[model samples]
Target: MMTMPSAPQLAVQASVKRADEILVVDDTPASLQLLADLLTEAGYVVRVAPEGAMALHSALARPPELILLDVRMPGMDGYELCRRLKAAPQTCNVPVIFLSALRETTDKLRGFTLGAVDYIGKPYQAEEVLARVRTHIDLHRLKTRLAEEVEQRTEELRLSSEELEEKRAQLQALMGFMHQVREDERTSIARELHDELGQSLTALRIELSWLRKHCAPLGEVVLERADAGYALVEQTVQSLRRISEGLRPGMLDVLGLCAALEHLVSQFAERTGVSCSFSADADDYRLPENGAITVFRLVQEALTNVARHAEASQVSVRLAQEKNSLHLCVSDNGRGFASAQPRQGFGLLGMRERVLLLGGEITIDGKNGTHIDVRLPLVKGE
Candidate 1:
């Protein structure tokens, strides 16, 4: 039967398999061999060089994970080699530790300033050298791993943000398309009602009048009934006209945005018994069909909200054109509510969606009654 390896034995095997590569530089052969042997015993692959020149050449050829350098040598000393290594792009990141006879505070500071990670005395203990080497190697590996992780996470976040922006753009386009379809449907319905229903009611009224006038010696009760029928037909015609206008106002297409808004305000005041005023900077300003409808609908929705929610007597609407943008304001003297809280109704949400589709902005303030301000660019992509 075969026996499985113990935990300690498994650990040793794992460490050997993942052994770190180290470069040892010294002026004396004995010192280089001793350091190499010590590192080799610790499961690290060790490369030895007798002087600074050889060490530099070896490192340039194939850079090691960590470097153990000596201070005093014939041609190029450890300090010079360390400075050169740090300057080189390929070997700049490799950690270097000084193993030298010079143990003075100034010598250590000089080594550190030259970018040496650590300094050790000439009569170095085997255990201390091994411990310091192990510590620096582990630290360098951890730092490298951490840097890679940070870069990867940053890339992921950038991609995610880009994806989110793309999705939002797609959704905005869909909303605009749906809004256009709804407007077209409304226009079609309004045309049908005006042409078909309005004509039928008019014909009915004429027939009733003819019956009342031409009937020979008609009874008073019968004549009275004909008159009542005529009145009902007239009322039905008026109701149908009003409903058709509400679906899509003809003034919006005929007179332009300002005139349509004025008609809307006057009608609201008459119906709701709320005093409403409208003012505009320009009377003859014309907008495209879509723009005219958008402005008209905005005013209509605002006034509707005021009538339903505002318990006040007075309201004001204003419009102005400045440079390449149009500004609109609607305010009322009514009971106020907090604007920062999430809106409970879809009225505000619908308004926001409309403004967004036009690349415009809308703000609502309820601090002093209710005030709504809107700004829209006259030209698309401007």
Candidate 2:
């Protein structure tokens, strides 16, 4: 009757059949031949080296799947050779096993400390050698696979992050172009309203007055209707002026950022009755035209939010210049929301996009009151 090989024996048989190479380093010819023949008959390709230097040379030339080293060799012993093998980058990952007659626990411990995968006592058993060799080769292969997988994952994450950043940049550029288009449209519409509709209303009001003066004979009822028509025309002209200014303030183009912000704050105060104060570091210092327009729009949106949502009575707007940057702050003592709560409206989002387009930052804090702080670089087209 024939006995079946155990699981470990089976694994060794399977691995050896694949022709995995094993390096044997021993000083004694008898022991070296014994290990070599035993491994060869078991179906592994075996190579023998007389001492540590020859073993290291053979291993470096073409690293084996496993190394069986004699601990008692003269000069460079197994421990020293193991250290050298581990230090060299190419052979560092190869599994090493120590062979020795030393039964002391310290001797075995020293081998393990020097990175040997296993230590076998000599007079060695053939089966034990084959089993340990098989176990370690499997572990080394698994470790290599895992390392490769990790490296692949890291590279994938790096690429994904770069792609996301590029998309974000593209979105910001689109927003900036749209913002410019909208500003140009507003300027055109405002000009049309002021120059075309405003003039027509004014001329009609003058004609109504002339008609009333020339036709007093029409009596009190006709005179009263004519006066009513004149008043209505005057009211329409005022509305058109207000709407045009709101669309694109002509003062912003003529007077620059500081004057425009002052006018905006004054109007907000007068309209909302929300005690507002405006201040600036210098009246003469101004940003480029586009930057000034963005800042003015930022302040305008902030004040609108405060009036509509904050329900606060006191508001303060401040502008300052520092080195190459312009800083603007808008704060209100109103019914503030939680800082963690998300802003649901497009106003804050638009303000943030506008600031970012110019390579700036905006932060909104809603603690005791809502506070918006913005920093913009003064560089052209930044």
Candidate 3:
């Protein structure tokens, strides 16, 4: 026997079959009614919004998968609506289709930038509307499914990556121990070469001199050549000094981090006429070795980018410590860009990765000027 279906059961089945909710936003009642009838007939649950304000409210209330937006509404037109919608976290993922009378490329680009899925002009054909709506619904479904899969895969990958990193860190610590031992061995060898072998060579030279005095009438040319040979030995000793310095900078050992940074800035400013200026209130005694180098490299990259892209005559770099966070800011008076635009290049991307590695954040923007801000936290063990 066939039992009649319950109202809730039927509703659930209806919802399962129809996964798309389309919002038709138009000011004209006639246009709204026409689009509503067409979409309703095409197996879609349609809601009509007479104005942009009503549309935004209704969209938040219902959260449509696809929005058919009109360009020329009374208050808060479609372009600005799209912009605000894209900015909001809840509505950013919702695909928008601009149905407008405006036919300019600039208008289309503006709509696209504001996260519009498609732009349909006025006097849209019935088949065209049906086809476009169907295409967008399918596209929206695909995107939603893809996002879910990506998120799931990302979570799994994150767990796997964390395990892998733990293993890598263990190996790195072992390798670090080995490296320290190797460095100690090298230091001992260097001392031996300079102390024992060097002393032996000096003694041999003195004995040669004594032999030269005993064996009289040694040619002047031979003595001059012997002096040149001694000069060569002195140059070899100088080369050894340079090699020792390369293993570890003596400036870092003797002058401290601030002096090293000042020397770096001096060299950077001398090469580029960007008039780089720095300000610090403290001795930067809080930052560890890695933290100090990170700050220095951050400024270095910012200035390098300025020299290449900023084309400005002057630049300013500042570093200050406040509480647990250290702030670094670099600004240049070049042609600024619209901060609202999506990122296009990778210079900032690399910098962001570097900051994130140290559990910090970096911001690169072109408002009044190209501004870069990096904030690094001084953790207990950091």
**Between the candidate structures 1 and 2, which one is better when assessed by lDDT?**
2
* Full candidate order by lDDT, most accurate first: 2, 1, 3
All candidates in order of TM-score, best leading: 2, 1, 3
Window of ten residues with lowest summed lDDT in model 1: 1-10
Candidate 3 on 48-139: residue-level lDDT in tens? 78888888888876688789999998999998888878877778888899988898999888888888989988888989988998998898
Q: Which regions of candidate 1 deviate over 4 angstroms? A: 1-19, 25-31, 48-63, 69-125, 209-224, 284-289, 310-312, 380-382
Model 2 quality (TM-score): 0.84
Give the root-mean-square deviation of each candidate in angstroms: 6.2, 5.2, 14.9
For lDDT, candidate 2 versus 3, the one ahead is 2
Top lDDT: which candidate number? 2
Badly placed stretches (over 4 Å) of model 3 are 1-18, 167-382
Q: Give TM per candidate.
A: 0.78, 0.84, 0.41
lDDT of 1: 0.85
Better of 1 and 3 by TM-score: 1
Instruction: Point out the worst 10-residue segment of candidate 3 by lDDT.
Output: 1-10
Model 3 error, position 354 (Å): 28
Candidate 1, pairs of clashing residues = none
